[model samples]
Target: MKTRNPLPIVRLAVAIAAAIGSCLPLARCAAEPAVRPPNVLVFLVDDLGYMDIGANNPDCFYETPHIDAFADSAMRFTDGYAANPVCSPTRYSLMTGRYPSRVDATNFFSGKRAGKFRPAPLNDKMPLEEMTLAEMLKTKGYATCFAGKWHLGPDEEYYPQNQGFDVNYGGWTRGGPYTGKRYFSPFENPQLQPDSPPGDHLPDRLARDTAQFIDSHRDQPFLACLSFYSVHTPLMGRPDLVEKYEAKASRIVGEEFAREEQVLGDKPRRVRILQKHAVYAAMVEAMDEAVGKVLQQLDDSGVRDNTIVVFTSDNGGLSTSEGSPTSNLPLRGGKGWVYEGGIREPWIIRYPGITQAGAVESTPICSVDLLPTVAASVGYELQHDVDGVDIGPLLHGESLADRDLFWHYPHYSNQGGIPSGAIRHGDFKLIERYEDGRVHLYNLSDDIGEQNDLASEQPEKVDQLRDRLHAWYQRVDAKFLQAKPDGPEPWRP
Candidate 1:
């Protein structure tokens, strides 16, 4: 009649279940069902050169304490490169993980300049059919926000919002901050309404907007693309910073800071041998300050530990032209040239648990690599073919197998660069000019400045690299410059 004491039996069964659960894998009985996805913060600086930051350039004049400190705490890629030597194309590559040539967006949006040969067909807008990084992440329930420059398309239909960003701020067609009276607000952007106080700097306002977006979306995974419209054209900076740089410029020691000139074609391009443009230095400092503000916000929101931060530029500095602002010296030509200076960039990535702090990877990485690396980080499977390989292994202190890097810019650059296609298979790089098909080879390890041409002595190496470059062009279905029907004019700078 005791009925086997059912209550005692039930208590014993519960105790046994607890013990088994404790012995099982933590993931099986974790209090938190799933770990939250890390947030992504991309700091895309316009026209920032490879040697612009103190970590890359030992004697850089501009004060980039924030960026330098960031590099010191992140993984620095010494041979990082942009997908193109121009803005829109590199930006497109960043978003799509494909070469700009594949989408026919090889130049800045609405860029119609003609040269000796007619430029290849241009795609003014990024096609909606192609998946964007934001779009891919959005599928995984991430909030995507874009702040600052968006030159992907000419119309509103192809803007950040239409391209999977839930929030778009200051994104428009123009490449530079040419609207809203340039840089300072009353910005002419339709997506971004002017709400800040008058005379507020654009970079600072964009940073604040990004911080606000992060604050609002703190509980969820988010992608905040902070593309700064700084160190671009209409180089304007805060007055106090400008004054400080001017004072610094005045106290310079010798003719050690003299400007040099080189003839690229018929025109003499003034090369900035030194990094002491007062206004430009100020602009760089302001941009760095803006970056500092965003980083500080991440710290304040307590998400710094779980956020992946990437800092890079669309292309090299605007040294050869466009006010000749900053310098990319000891590397060769500036933005638009298919040289070390034009494509090489200051790339830094920070992933709290994955990447070792202060590590340096000399293995060259391109802007297209960003999407795949980020996708891998978030456990997203990429369905489309991407030109860039996931560099996640490199982040973890492993070396990637040597691969050929390619660049094809068939149109003449406004910055005094000729049309050319280049490829680097190893320590050597071969550049083939579209005008004459003449190839120039350089041993980048020995001649980082690209001063010596070793094509004659290294003919076989040139042939090998050229063949690989042409093969890549065919693989990517790259378009080439066509001879004008009226016959090509004499090549000019």
Candidate 2:
């Protein structure tokens, strides 16, 4: 009659057995590792500012409920950075896990369009030699897909199909569909006649194709890179959505939405205002909805727990047309400069058991780190040299040692910015301008706004940072012009 206590002992044994079962596989795998690859979903937004989402900046013009919720459900990195200050270069570093200058494709391509200020860029594709995170995951038998924008390289020779993605859609437009020729139209504009629209709306099409890819690949481990092109330039928004934002913008302006701007190519004064601020805000809202759809599909497919979802942007928020008047106030310059706003982005990583939700990590992590981090997560070892270290440890609440991060933007930008290179060593940052050979140094911990130029007073600090930047350039074989013949000495401390 007293033998009923077997229930307690039985439960204890079961718990022990379960623990051993989990540990045993990991031990066995370490000896002869079978891949421990988890599904990866990278939701990349374009031209998203540091303060765009409510989780990052509650007072942003647009309300991104989905993005804010996702950030809350994930581990957010406050000091996350993009490799470059501008789009194409930032993306080059993102996909290749190396600096864009290394690839020698740091500028935007114009699809054979020639003009005074614009020069023909080297081929747009991320060279075949570079290994992409998507490609690396394929080694572990993972299904790969890329949706949204792909401004990496030229098509045919360097399309997503060749870059380790099993499926890709709506990614290969030159510059932007809205600004480019008929071939790149945003809507069923002049370009729809021949190539079949990338879809009704660029973001919608990317989202739809992405959902389909997940549905088809749910049975297996997958690496989905869903890069949304919403919020970028050429603000040709969906008509219904445009009307919604038009009312919002009109109320803010205390006037009706300018009909002149809506007339298509009318080039009114209000045209820049509507396209840049109003359409940009609407695009962000659309991108947020698109992300929600993909996340919903993952849940419905029964793979939410086993997937690692990363949300980030290519670069800082675009400060010009199609962007909100949000403040990177303290962050200094916007896109195309060596300031916080241009290169800083919101980074969130969600992995069920491995990472804690609603956590914020202040360690500096950049897009280049994604390669090694994802590689390690998927149980793959990287043999080649990677500029960015694995940030997986930081995401898991480990103490990250101090390290220096550097950036180089060699080309000129149309956004009223000069060529600059910056080096971040701990709390201090040194920015050097190639045009005037000026150095502006700031202790970022004290001045996130970059208001004071301490270089004048701190000669020792300036020399130290300059030495580090030059050494790094030499080590990486970075591309830089040998100061133009007529220009003054471009190298200065």
The candidate that wins on TM-score is 1
lDDT of 1 by residue, 1-493 (tens): 5657689889999999798877885536555568889999999999999988888987999889999899988999999999999999999999999999887888888776776678777889999988999999998999999999999998888989999999999898889888666877677667778556678888999999999999889889999999998888888878898899999989875433233332234546666666778899999989999999999999999899999999999999977887777778888888988888899998999999988889999998999999999999999999889988899999999988789888888777888777788998788889888776778899989999887999999878877887888888888888877768889643321
Instruction: Give the 10-residue window scoring lowest on summed lDDT in candidate 1.
Output: 255-264
Structural similarity to truth (TM-score) of each candidate? 0.94, 0.82
lDDT tens digits by residue: candidate 2, 1-493: 5657688899999999789878787455346645445899998888787877878886566768988888888899888999887777777777767877676565655322211123223446688888888788888899998876777765555767787888776566444555333223344422122334544556766677788889888888998998877667765556666668768766564322221111112232221112225566677788888888999999898889889999998777765334334345446656666788678899999987878879999888888888888888878899788877788787788977788888887665544344668888988999876545678899988898787889989999999999998898787666543444454444433
Model 2 Cα displacement at 153 (Å)? 1.4
In order, candidate lDDTs are: 0.87, 0.71
Error of 1 at 61 (Å): 0.3
lDDT of 1 at 294: 97
lDDT of 1 at 139: 88
